[model samples]
Target: MAKKDYYKILNLSRDASQTDVKKSYRRFARKYHPDVNPGDDIAVQRFKEVKEAYEVLSNPHLRDQYDTYGRTDLDSGDVSHGTTYGGADSVEVNNDVFETDVDSDIYEVSTGEDPYSQPGGGPEPGSDLSFELTINFENAVYGAEREINVPTFRICEACSGSGSAPGTKTAECKTCQGTGQVFERDRYSGEMSLVQCKACYGRGKIIQTPCMRCNGNGSFQTYEKILIKIPPGVDNGSRLRIHGKGTPGVRGGPPGDLYIVIKIKDHEIFERHGNEILCEAFITFPQAVFGTEIEVPTLDGTAKMKIPPETQPGTIFRLRGKGIVDMHTGARGDQHVKISIVVPKNLSERQRGLLYKYARTTGEL
Candidate 1:
């Protein structure tokens, strides 16, 4: 079957930029995420397709491979094809981008087709992977570098991802006579149907001595440590891309990317909206009655704001340029401090008399 074009799946042009790909993914994922479309099988399936398309299109290496080869076979990095493996291709929209049931689509399959064969030395692009990184609110505001260990696949160093032992080579598969697929002639319909050759798993070749390190799969699981930088003004759900840090590509293909999904912890005193911050401040009756300058907490540092005389509770004061920095533009937002008047809990006799006297003087007792 032919593979679905990832650019079409993401509603993108062949020349779309990385930023465009990201924007499209976010817009589509929000509409089709399982949480947004509960119990809808079609929506669930579409969401998965959208995710798969994004996984391929968002990464530079993978997108290039998918474009050049017309397939996204990251595993074992087989880049020697210009046509999709099977005639089994599907539609543009509402297509199943991730062909999990068909291993030949995502991985190597034995083939007699020389044009599609991946020689022992060609670079196979790696699969793109995602990780969710939880960070403190302050770190998101101030920006910080963090080290993380990602559990993913890397090309086998021992076999160099060829699936054969060192100094050895793969032999042509015999089941399909070097053809990666088998054909059956139906008498009644007079139809010829093609099926993947199981002998060499459609690779049209067999590795007599598989690499012991990777067991012929050409990749292994390991944890990789990477340092990622968090940009200032990043809030929860911000996504950052780390190129060439994901699953390693096949044979000698370039590594895939690691997408970092940000999750900022809730702050104790402040809540963020876009680049702005909202916080609550408490002032005594005297402070509100006589206009005073008070220190207010900001993401940067303490800032002084004036409370006008006769200030009312629930009034919001704007502290310009004291909120989070704009991630893209580098501009700053204002901080909104909501005022809450604090009344004395326990009144002494002298305090109660003073308040009454003061109220009477103001003609409000």
Candidate 2:
């Protein structure tokens, strides 16, 4: 049978969002489920078809693979193509603009037929995987280039993730009986979680001969080298999105994303309070009294500052454009130099005598 566009089956676009895929599936199911349609075979088939489409494209990884490979094997419950590995084919989104991330555990299980295809069940995508990444403090701050290793259940290239060793047809799931979703009716139990048939792991087909590399799971856990670019000036708890980098979705669904969460390390000498930076500098009594020239530390390097005569301890001197850079506006904040006067621990007799003389002259002897 010629392949059907699973997107149209679910009444969703090929580029529909995850939410849209889910909503479309729910609507399709409501209209076609056997319980709802009451023995309508056409509606039953449509329900299975829409469900298959939702299973794949909703996942980012699966969708990317499907988009790239354009394989119609999913309709026959064939996972014949293993993942074509590469990191440059990744997706990236700017967080400063969107500023949001989502964490979810997605499962893509195919059963019975080509759930998303033009055939009996429809078309479907591939499986999805999930994992977590931890970034460094400085990397989180300046954004960095890094390579990481991850695990995924990619399709089996040998037998094509088909779980079949070679050119063998997989059997339809007996529990769900290729329907993918098993219906349960209990007198007391009002609603149920619509358990995916465990026999096929919710995929309507069973592998006759499993692939050696993936052990019939259709994928392996070998880590791939992935290099990522972190953006500049991302604050702590910020998230960087790498598209098409998540686990492979079903035969045709979209893949998930790699969410890089920024964990900025606190600076030892400087403390950041919003847009401003605060630090303490010790000044001698003469510098405070006579208003002398002092070198102050700022983001742009060292600058000569005029200490006003009679400047007391704890005096704050603002240095324009010297603090932390603003991520949004690109404007800089002023560095607040808080002066602290330190008294010398040891005093010479000559200095003491001079101080006594000056004190007497000042009428404070």
Candidate 3:
């Protein structure tokens, strides 16, 4: 393999600060990490490249030596005497690998960079699923509750949430000595660091005899019915929240919420805009010319509406407090019905003759 340029690999300038180099290293590491890529060969190699770049650029003295004298100083060229203690021999090592009094505390622990990757960080909440449920236009105007049969896991009856069998106890966390932390002591920097215990994972205990029902996973797979509440006057995309209705959380955590989105089915005779309702009713030409009583649809039973004499086409009749009710407030909205005159599609011979005679008598076109 060709020797790679660490600076170019990290996309840092020659005069870039140490922090800049570290940030670049972290960015590339997150992208090319083996954990993120799983079985990707190219990503694995790129991960190695990012690690190597950080290994060189993270150290101040090594970066300076590489910048000034190039790669020659990294191998051999010059030697320096450093302090020794406790009968240790005077060892000649590159300043980059040797730590002074002020190195960061993160290097004292394991090589893993991510913080949330401890063993205790397991899957918790169940996923939130969504599906469309349509309600009747009237039912939507009025709130309702329906018992929906949805697929979701509930608490396991066999082992509860503990995973261990009944009458059994869990073992103490051996990795952190029940404190749930790994104490790291660095002789080179003389600083103590604490990290989450990778073994017992801050739980301070472990199950001895695993539950046969849940396989010590502390959760079971099953389906249960849940009731969904639909509020009145809930338009499309109106979301109703149901607490503790989502998937069960892991390790005795509370379950998440399930949101029921409200959608009103289209009414056959009415169209709604906001809280108001609009409908178009067809009337005969005679009905518009002469006053007549007509039955109109409303939330209540059909009611008779009076049409004034000489009523023209495209005239709207307002029915106060007859429209859909406001969901937030109990106030009802008025319904507007526009009347349009209908003309006969096919004219009879007598009708044509009468219309022609009337046009001649009135001198109208």
- For each candidate, give its TM-score against the true structure: 0.58, 0.54, 0.50
Best by lDDT: 1
Instruction: Please give, for residues 247-274, the per-residue lDDT of candidate 1 as tens digits.
Output: 6766566675566667777889999898
Per-residue C-alpha lDDT of model 2 across residues 302-338, encoded as one tens digit per residue: 8888888999999898887776555444566777888
Q: lDDT per prediction?
A: 0.69, 0.57, 0.62
Candidate 1 at residue 132, lDDT?
A: 67
Q: Write the per-residue lDDT of candidate 3 for residues 231-250, one digit (tens) a residue.
A: 45666655444445556765
103 Cα displacement, candidate 3 (Å): 67
Error of 2 at 361 (Å): 9.0
Single out the weakest 10-residue window by summed lDDT for candidate 3.
103-112
Q: What is the lDDT of residue 319 in candidate 3?
A: 92
lDDT of 1: 0.69
Error of 1 at 14 (Å): 19
Over 4 Å off in model 1, which ranges? 1-123, 152-154, 166-209, 356-365
Candidate numbers, best TM-score first, in rank order: 1, 2, 3
